[model samples]
Target: MIIAEQKPIQEIKAMIAGYQKVLIVGCDTCVTICMAGGRKEVGIIASCLRMALQIDRKKPQLIEDCIQRQCEWEFVDTLKDKVDGVDAILSSACGVGVQALAERFPNKPVYPALNTTFMGMPNEHGLWVENCRGCGNCGLGRFGGICPIARCSKGLLNGPCGGSQNGKCEVSKEMDCGWQLIYGRLKTLNQLDQLEDILLPKDWSTDRDKGQRKMFRGDVYYEQTV
Candidate 1:
């Protein structure tokens, strides 16, 4: 899931202070699971902002609302009615959601209330760890499901750096060596022999440097809609 954390209250205040009415939009998908941008968080932020604004002798005309997703135009369209009333929009979703809102409502000032961190999974109750870099090409098959590109500190594809000691990454004592984890996982699967296979170089064409990427399935998409 896409992981994100809310921006500081002071920063949020500065962004919406100029506007008379602001709408806070929350996402019910990725950000909700990670406890960042959700219905609960929307209320929390709204209440906090109201109090903060009160201290500044400003009347808070903040409107709190949530949608299924802020990334999809279908979900974003729900905001059309709400958008007509607000002067500014503060999105509590990830960076993508913020951009979706901006693209959908170009006239309104769309402000991101969270810093989109990474594509990660929940490690614990409130902890999230980066798992994949979404490098466009997937090579998890060779590494026993452990992605060396994302787990490795240096994004090593072949093996652990020689700097790893006691299964800990040389970069940090608390961090596990990604390659070491891969070796152990492969050993457990009794497929350690695959380690001898040389992996191909990363396909940079699908990389972010390649520019805005889009995917379509003709089976589910209609040409007329696009």
Candidate 2:
């Protein structure tokens, strides 16, 4: 999932302070699972903003709402009624969601409440780890599912950098050598012979270096409503 963390309250307050009315919008998808932009977080942020404004003798209206998602226009359209009453929108979704809102409501100013961290999953309770770089080219078939591009400190494709000690990456003791993990996994699978295969230099052009990428689906089409 897309992982993100909420921005500091002070920063959020400063962004909406100039507006007479603000709406705090939450996303019930990725941010919710990370506990950053869920319904409960929206309420907490809204209440805190109200209290802070009251102390400063400011009377700006504050409202909170959470939608199923902010990335899709269908879910964002549900905010038409609530957004009409607010001067600005504070989006507690990921960067994608913030941009979606900005595109949908060109006249209104949109502010992000969270920093989009990475595409990852929870390793344990409250602990998330980066797994994939989404480089557009996937080589997991040769690496036994461990991503060398993201997990390796130097993004090595062939093997460990020869600097690993006791399976720990040379860059940090806390980090496991990604290649070492791959070797161990492949060894267990009895596919260590594949390691002898020579790999060509990775084609980085398919990655973010090329710029924003997109996918099109020919099977799905939109239906017009009269």
Q: lDDT, candidate 2, residue 166? A: 97
Return the top candidate by TM-score. Answer: 1
Off by over 4 Å in 1: none
TM-score of each: 0.96, 0.94
lDDT of each: 0.93, 0.92
Scored by lDDT, the top model is 1
- Cα error, candidate 1, residue 206 (Å): 1.5
TM-score, cand. 1 vs. native: 0.96
The positional error of residue 14 in candidate 1, measured at the CA in angstroms, is 1.1
Our tally of clashes for model 1 stands at 0
**Tens-digit lDDT track for model 2 on 1-226?**
9999988887888898899989899999999998889999899888888888777788898888999999999999999888888899999999999999999988899999999999999999899889999999999999998999999999988888889899999898999999999999999999999889989999998898878998767688656676
